[model samples]
Target chain A: MKISARNKLDGEIEAVDLGAVMASIKIKVEDPGVLTALITKESAEGLGLKKGDKVSAIIKSTEIIVGKE
Target chain B: MKISARNKLDGEIEAVDLGAVMASIKIKVEDPGVLTALITKESAEGLGLKKGDKVSAIIKSTEIIVGKE
Candidate 1:
């Protein structure tokens, strides 16, 4: 997955796998209602991400929190 | 604030305030570490956002979780 960067706040990126190393890199932000992540454990060990390794998911935009679920 | 939409998962938007009444519009998702928002509630009453109203904050990228402070 790739996106390098975006606007309004922050959305930078870098991702590589298949033994390419450089496995984790991400940043996306928008905090109004609540939505924040600042990950960096060597990119979770270059994407080795233990405990589970099924990545990719995103949310931003004033931390969307609509009412009356 | 506006962004419309983005990819890699989901990032949609539509924010307008200034008595224009069209305030809420957001969608950001990245559920690996936990950063998911789907706000609506008429855009939190068109940005009037009671209970406090100071917008803008963002965090995505596998829900960013790093250890070893």
Candidate 2:
């Protein structure tokens, strides 16, 4: 399905760490190097994510913050 | 100051479209081509954002989602 979120990065899953409520997954992308995603444990299990699994980190424009250097 | 968000993309503000409540800002980055950020009108004005302004698009890891093809 198509999404409205502007950012969608494809990469291989480097690691997955699940906690009581949240799960931390690391994805290694070519352009931005690596991106870390903190998602719900239920969502992680629902997606059947594992090491070496190819996935995309999806982010919405509304969730992004603009910062000045 | 530093933030916990893992994704911090440096870019230049290409344009800013402010509405009554929300604002849509376009940022041109080197790696990801161009990114669109939906920020509040208050934040857009508070930061004094304008076209050609150098800025960074910051995103929290928790706000990211994992999508598989």
Candidate 3:
């Protein structure tokens, strides 16, 4: 599936190993304990998203929540 | 953080219990093996996203990957 044009959130992105070809992306917010991410089985064959590699998290607005403290 | 506009993808949405107040949103695609999701530590108190809740999976272009079989 091809995804284009979506909301972007500025946060620290980190990749975590999920065994085999699956991996998880971690988005660290500045609010201390808030964390978000997009998990996929899409392997990082050539994308070069390593454990410590930095990347931008692209989020769709519909996937986000507001007014939560 | 407030998000208003973004791209959305149609998929089967399900909420999984992640212990405590944290929960995981599962996006089931038609491809069967390809599962994707946006994990948020944000609780589902008033959002009403239950285990069988039906919702759409919003995705951002930058978070998508192409060319893999």
- Prediction RMSDs, each to the true structure: 11.9, 2.0, 10.0
In candidate 2 chain A, where is summed lDDT lowest over 10 consecutive residues? A1-10
Please name the candidate that would achieve the greatest TM-score relative to the true structure. 2
Which lDDT tens digits does candidate 2 get at residues A6-41? 577678999999999999999987666778899999
- DockQ, all models: 0.18, 0.68, 0.05
Per-residue lDDT of candidate 1, residues A1-69 (tens digit): 333222233333333222343334333333322222345546656555443223333434444343321
Tell me the spans in candidate 3 whose CA falls farther than 4 Å from its real position. A1-69, B1-6, B20-22, B32-34
Clashing pairs in 3: none
Candidate 2 positional error at B43, Å: 2.0
- Error (Å) of candidate 1 at residue A11 is 7.9
Candidate 3 achieves a global lDDT of: 0.53
- On the 0 to 100 scale, the lDDT of residue B21 in model 1 is 39
Q: What is the fnat of model 2 with respect to the true interface contacts?
A: 0.77
In candidate 2, stretches whose alpha carbon ends up further than 4 angstroms from where it belongs are: none
TM, every model:
0.25, 0.84, 0.38
